[model samples]
Target chain A: MKIGIIGGGAVGLLFAGYLGQKFDVTLIVRRELQLQSLLMNGITVHKGGSSFTTRVDSDLLTEVSMKFDFVIVAVKEYDLKPLEKVLELMDKNQPLLFLQNGIGHLEWVESLPHHNLLAGSVEHGALKENDHVLHHLGVGKTNLALIKGEWGAVEELVSQSIPSFPFLLKQDFEEMLLTKLFVNVLINPLTALTRVRNGKLVENPHLHQLQRDLFQELLLLYPHMERNVSFEGVVEICNNTYENRSSMLKDIESERKTEIESILGVLLEKAQREHHFVPIMNVVYRLVKGIEREGLGG
Target chain B: MKIGIIGGGAVGLLFAGYLGQKFDVTLIVRRELQLQSLLMNGITVHKGGSSFTTRVDSDLLTEVSMKFDFVIVAVKEYDLKPLEKVLELMDKNQPLLFLQNGIGHLEWVESLPHHNLLAGSVEHGALKENDHVLHHLGVGKTNLALIKGEWGAVEELVSQSIPSFPFLLKQDFEEMLLTKLFVNVLINPLTALTRVRNGKLVENPHLHQLQRDLFQELLLLYPHMERNVSFEGVVEICNNTYENRSSMLKDIESERKTEIESILGVLLEKAQREHHFVPIMNVVYRLVKGIEREGLGG
Candidate 1:
């Protein structure tokens, strides 16, 4: 089955770069500059000292070429609506997988009458160098679990295309998605507001206590959640991701609307609906909202 | 009557610059460079945007051309012993004024059987520009208090010299020294370690609460003690010197052996002596000691 990747940022381009060689792939980038640049320089995937560039066709994304077997949305969470309208034009039988950090996408897509949407999580610290360039600063597993059917075929494709990196096909979809959401809520808002790196948290006892506070509050609200499998038993991922900017931190640093809206923002709403008090998360949400209201990211 | 000024640092040089006009003065500096610089260029007082330079003989200190009627020891409190040895060569009938912050000078000088040791408190923020130059940043007041016999003549002389600025004839020498000690404990450690200016304290609520905790703890131990005096209703003299760097901050920034040993270190010792646990001060002392041990200033 042919795969079509939507969005042309690091996440989108990296996926297209990695999956292009194994399958029939076309990268759907919105801007003419991105398309032109990709056509000229290809897409650079930098890992360690090695780098590779891949060719992508932008024209295949128009409603005319909406024939792919799978569609992956790779934009920041707030930019999902316009592309969701475009995804409306695609074949409804094809599976849709979201590779964003936050939980709102699952809710948004689930609200629509789509039969084949998959909740996915990528802990990969993929950083965008430029319009058509990327850096994989950290290697986190890509978990793809179907909300409806078995992911055996997807697993086969992933196993065939695996490049010495970890990928997973888990059956417990909602809990897996919630676990990733828990990790995002705990780390992203904290690192964003405090302007500290992953390594710096352990240096300050106050911040370490803050991390535990967020964990306790999240656990109290969503007790059914499993610890983040990527970061849970594997205790060293946080230290390893030292000095590497979280995408939310990068958003705040670059003066862009952060994924806090999808992560903590939606969780706050859900907590209110469930009649639960999350003091720690409420603090993070309010601070980020104040930052956004001040036109900080505008 | 003749006077002798000890230490070639800014404090000694500044007093020498002004007091040289008032009395026949001799400045004793340890370093040959400082001694030669003062002898060649004269002590320059950069006060109120105008420069006043005054010349004094270098050999008069040892040549015994005149006997000292007053001696002002203005070195860092740590180097008190050399001044003690120098005192052996001087006339024993003179009154000595200590122009240093913190409380240990009283104990050290009290150990000597001198004729009279008058305690003086100067809140002037001065920086050593060069060996022979001093920059007086802020002008608060110098309070001269007599610790021994007949305060009548000394008070009149100090009152007549600076009738314009706020100078006090503080009879309560112990209270006056303790007042300066208490204020330095708060202002110096907070500003220097945090590397924050006085006004910047208002920006962070966390830091503000920490200040409150420290203040409240000090209040618990010493009830009804008000070091916070106002020329017009303001408590801290530090607020008057807002933009100026505290001497403690300058010491830390310049990587010098801090007066922390005499300041907070003495406070901790005093608290232990009184059998009362100063929780906040203990924390501050430990934190500063940790900073000193870590060579953070380096």
Candidate 2:
């Protein structure tokens, strides 16, 4: 099976490196420098105190010449706009998987004519050191669910999964995505606003109070989330990933755009539709949005 | 006339320097170091491109012996509890003036048996350089209103006002304190949490939106406040004091305890009492409280 990933970010590079071992993989990057470097040096994967090099095909997103068995849409939600034409031209029968955070892309993905669409939540922590190298910081399973198609359509993807980088199947697409969304919503903006690691939210009493208040608001807004997961489970994630810096904080530190719109922005929209009052979320949403605007310029 | 000012903070030192010129002023200080410095060099008042020195008696709060015509409680709301014994020692016949920020001290002040009590909202910006020196950043008027007793008892306080530090008498005590509380609530926590100056809230669109949302919630929570001030009025203050660093932000930077409890804490209490939902204020209150805990330890 041949796989084509349409991003050169940490997640894209990570998937390429791991999947290149069993099947042919091509990384479609935006920058020429990243593409050239990847073509020259292949890709490096650093995991579990061990490093390995994997050879994979590389191409610019616009210059992809061959069709693949599966195409993983691994870019950020913000970068999805430019890939509209590319996605439209792709083989409609081939399965397309989205690995972006937040539920912002659900509506957009539903509109696409692709017959087999999959939504994935990447649980593993991966950070790109450079254009051609990535460090798999944490080993975790990727949860994949069918958004609008049969899971059997991507059976090749399930077969390619190794123990080190496993892909677990989820039955309900909404439940899986919403479960992930709940964690991201509570964790991402708070860490970005506070500039603290995940653990501090649970470590500090006042912050824990704040986390609980925010969680209460989230539960009130979306009670269905409560049936899927508990607040303690979320706190457990904070404990487990205590030292890790959230990607939102990294985005702010690097002056890059954050995924706040997809995460918090989506929740705010739902709150508005239901005419629910969510003061805590509103304040955080505006604050993170304000910080993002200042960081990214307008 | 003899005036005793409690607390050696910026507001306390400011009152001491200004009132010492007209009245025999004795500043009640907390630390021996501050008392020694004030005794050795008097108090320096820096304002409007000029500086001057004024001599005022300084003593430890425990050593305050002489009865005064008026006593100004210029300490923070948090520090007021420790002064319970001292407040009991104060002459109940003489008017006592409280010059703390926020509405947290309202109920406590009312509970005091002092027959003549006045609440002051200090508008002037004063930054203490050291124990005995202060720089008056702005020449704003101080608003005074009777909290529990007759205003005529504290007439000497109004009479001693100088040109640079004028005291403007306000008719409605609730109106005056609530007005100040409104400004503090809007500016203090936002600047402190975002670590921006007062002006950035208005200069940044998203922050300004958050400010407006918070202001709307305030108006809803306390409709009486709406009759006293408008949202545009608050924005105008933000514009006027654009370069000003909120005391809370300064407190955070200095690793000192913030006035979060007095400002945001008081507002949250009111929201709880009125059964009003204030999400933004709740989050900011908790976050600032969390930061304060971390800064001060436990």
Q: Fnat of the models, one by one? A: 0.00, 0.72
Q: Choose the strongest candidate by lDDT.
A: 2
Which ranges in model 2 have alpha carbons more than 4 Å from their true place? Answer: A40-42, A47-50, A53-55, A148-154, A216-225, B48-50, B148-154
Which predicted model would earn the best DockQ? 2
For candidate 2, the share of real interface contacts preserved is: 0.72
Model 1 agreement with the true structure over A255-280: per-residue lDDT tens digits: 76777788987788888999987756
Clashing residue pairs in candidate 1 (N, C-alpha, C atoms within 3 angstroms): none
| Cα lDDT of model 2 by residue, A208-271, tens digit | 8878878888888779878998989999999988888999989988888899998989889999
List of clashing residue pairs for candidate 2 = A279-B279, A279-B280, A280-B279
Q: Model 1 Cα displacement at A158 (Å)?
A: 7.9
Give the alpha carbon lDDT tens digit for every residue of B22-133 in model 2.
8899999989999999999999999878999999999999888849888889988888988888888877887888888878778888998889889898889999999999
Off by over 4 Å in 1: A1-298, B57-67, B79-93, B104-106, B147-157, B163-166, B203-207, B226-239, B268-298
Candidate 1: residue B37 lDDT (0-100): 82
